[model samples]
Target: MDIDKLSIKKKRVMIYFIEAARRLMASEGVRALSIRGIAEIAGYNSATLYNYFDDLQHLTLFASMSYLRDYVSALSGNLKPPMSSLQRYRVIYETFDHFAFRSPEIFYNMFFGRQSAKLPEVVVQYYALFPEELKEHFPSVRKMLTQGDMYRRDEPIVEELVRDGFVRPENASPLSAVVPRLNQTYLHELVNGKDISPEEQHRRFIAVFDYLLETAK
Candidate 1:
């Protein structure tokens, strides 16, 4: 296989698998994600998936990366002509909420329900939406760090580049990394598996999220 041809072949296989996974999750939920089932869904044998990925885990990871990329693109489209960094972040967040609600089976299956927490590099790069999509998530995060206000936020406020957005910080990541690093503080088992009331779960998760969102405001 020549390099270009090999890339094209791989791309088609990946797309087929992504569609299969999406259909399965749309109909049967994440638990429906078995190697056999995905193979069937893609009109190929399980062996084909092996050629593209080591196992079902990698396949699903790839699907998730593609999904997030499409997700950000779609949300960005629904926003005003050109949105600011904060605006872009907020739009994507709301889009996430909507997508989660509409496709509970698929969304839950891909996340929270998966045994893996491995976010692929490709996924991180495309949905960035900030200075660069890969680290676009950084600007909002860095913004949070620089501010010490109920909102007296101001470090480098200039509208000299990128049109709707500002030039990204020269010194970034020290504080903003904490935003994307939020999953580090979250505990799924404690919240999802326990006998706690709904209110309690809301209170706990909200508290964590509130602190984060508050700083952004």
Candidate 2:
């Protein structure tokens, strides 16, 4: 549903529901989410929640995004100018891993799970309803957060590498493709209880990423 088309009252109700879900996810984690639970916290019944969202997963996706605030906020400090495009990319991913590994399930569901395809639209809807959450980000950072496709999100950085002559034009696509896959490999394991510490996970990911960059050059 287009949130922009909704009545003011309806938009308010949806915010209530989304906020309730966010509270639950923050307090108890994503696995504890349920339609009844969200509706109860929102001061509505489950049927009313359906009026605002297609299903629990839909609501969960929006709720999970609340976790991204920390990641997005950290980028401002980590991605200072005078850094090369490749350095910026590395900092971005490292910053991402710092937050993502701590909440692997939420990150996995938001980016790699079945509902991930709907994320671009959901992100638009989310910001429409809560534009305040976006006001602090720089324009480039805003664009990066709103880009829902993991591959497309990283493609520009790879293209920057090509423009800067760090990578050949022919290698840009493959470099973009492999980087996300490599991250996903670690994320998938972490999500599945791989028994790795977040610190170890961060180190491993950067080591492998550095190796890939060397090979791509």
The local distance difference test score of model 2 is 0.84
How well does each candidate superpose onto the true structure, as a TM-score? Answer: 0.48, 0.88
On residues 18-52, what C-alpha lDDT tens digit does candidate 2 reach at each position?
99999998788888999999999999989998887
Cα deviation at 38, candidate 2, in Å, is 1.3
- For candidate 1, the per-residue lDDT at 149 reads 25
Deviation of model 1 at 79, angstroms: 4.4
Q: Pairs clashing in candidate 2?
A: none
Q: Which portions of model 1 show Cα errors greater than 4 Å?
A: 1-3, 7-18, 41-44, 61-70, 78-89, 100-174, 183-210, 213-217
The clash numbers for all candidates, in the given order, read: 4, 0
Please give the distance, in angstroms, between residue 38's alpha carbon in candidate 1 and its true position after superposition: 2.1
